[model samples]
Target: MIESISKASAVSGTKATESFSSLFEAPAATLEGTGATALNGETFMSALGNVAMQAANNLKRGEEVSFDGLTGKANTREVVDAVMQAEQSLQTAIAFRDKIVNAYLEITKMQI
Candidate 1:
């Protein structure tokens, strides 16, 4: 999967770079006192939700493709690719969940 992703980025070249930069481009606004920029609550939550949904969709697609392969609808390569991608996504989601849980625990241990 990493090889495929690298090949894809290589194929896209400058277009991929432009898209990546544009996607993460900073907003213009800054906080009143801190002068630091941050995503507003709604925007942050929406982005997080979108990521979660995408992962879920990927996992579902992988399952569907596996079933299709069993039914002779999808080929071996397609099923393998989908399954690998889904596994990667699941690992990422698990890592994120672990980080969040650890952060919460740390916060609880902090002195107010």
Candidate 2:
């Protein structure tokens, strides 16, 4: 029973991540009239913004799942999955941010 539950969660977690990532497939679409070059610079910021939004959404979903689990409206397995996914998303965002900061520091350290 435990193994089956874990397997189910693993599958669902993958699906959820895929759906979230799919949201960023076309960041430039909303700016229909702008030249593609303008969008090129915006794309990095847009992707970062999207990732931050996803992390927030995942954390919110985790809270909802936890509440549901507490009230007996959701399965424990689901709560575990939601919380785990949220934690992973948060960690990834933080790491990405740290990498960006490090890059900025390195650039600033250059004599140029």
Candidate 3:
């Protein structure tokens, strides 16, 4: 899956600078509550929800493709590609969730 991702990214040359760490980064918090300033917790949860939804959608698509392939209505290549993409998306979403959970755990450990 990693090899396929690297190959795809190399061909596109559009996602070169984005590392895995950046995917889980919490966006900058505003100094004061004002226009365009979303609560940091809300923003993080929104991001997490978006990524999870995407991963779920990918998996659903992959499952559909697999079923189609079984029925001889879709190409095997489509199934393989969809499943691979779903796998990568799921891994990414899981990693993001783990990072958020770990950060929360660390914060809870801090003494007042």
Candidate 4:
């Protein structure tokens, strides 16, 4: 009886292993369909232009508030808010630029 049980257990283990192996094997047709989109220069430049425009807008608003005065023309809080927004926008733009430069340098160092 012990021998019979051992044989049954081995058969079940073999079946389980076969099923697990099939789970990872991709169909040939599925593999053929998988592809990657390539990034190009236009997309990169457009994204950079967007960030610069946003930063410029923020600074322009801050300047407008400062020039118009905080009396009745503009609320004291509005001027302060504009200035803070401009500062944050500029800082974010600078950080993003640094990150992109670092990535470019790292990629250039990689082997083909």
Q: Which portions of model 2 show Cα errors greater than 4 Å?
A: 1-42
lDDT of 3 by residue, 15-108 (tens): 5324443454445544233345545446443465566666777877887888899999999899899989988987887798698789879989
Model 2 lDDT tens row, 1-112:
2233234334434767567546544445554555444445454545666677677778878989999999999999999999999889879978997998898799889996
What local distance difference test score does each model get? 0.71, 0.71, 0.67, 0.67
Model 3 scores worst on lDDT over the 10 consecutive residues at 4-13
Off by over 4 Å in 3: 1-42
CA error at residue 112 for candidate 1, angstroms: 1.0
Evaluated at residue 17, the lDDT of candidate 3 is 29
lDDT of 4 by residue, 30-91 (tens): 55588633244233444555677777778777878877764469888888999899889879
Please say which candidate is ahead in TM-score: 1 or 4. 1
- What are the models' TM-scores? 0.66, 0.62, 0.61, 0.56
Candidate 1 Cα errors over 4 Å, as ranges = 1-33, 38-42
Q: List candidate 4 stretches off by more than 4 Å.
A: 1-42, 70-72
State in Å the error of residue 8, model 1.
Answer: 32
Relative to the unseen true structure, what is the C-alpha lDDT of residue 5 in candidate 1, on a scale of 0 to 100?
35
lDDT of 2 at 26: 46
lDDT of 3: 0.67
Task: Give the root-mean-square deviation of each candidate in angstroms.
Answer: 13.0, 13.7, 13.5, 25.2
- The true-versus-predicted C-alpha distance at residue 74 of model 4, in Å, is 1.7
- Give the Cα-based TM-score of candidate 1 against the true structure: 0.66
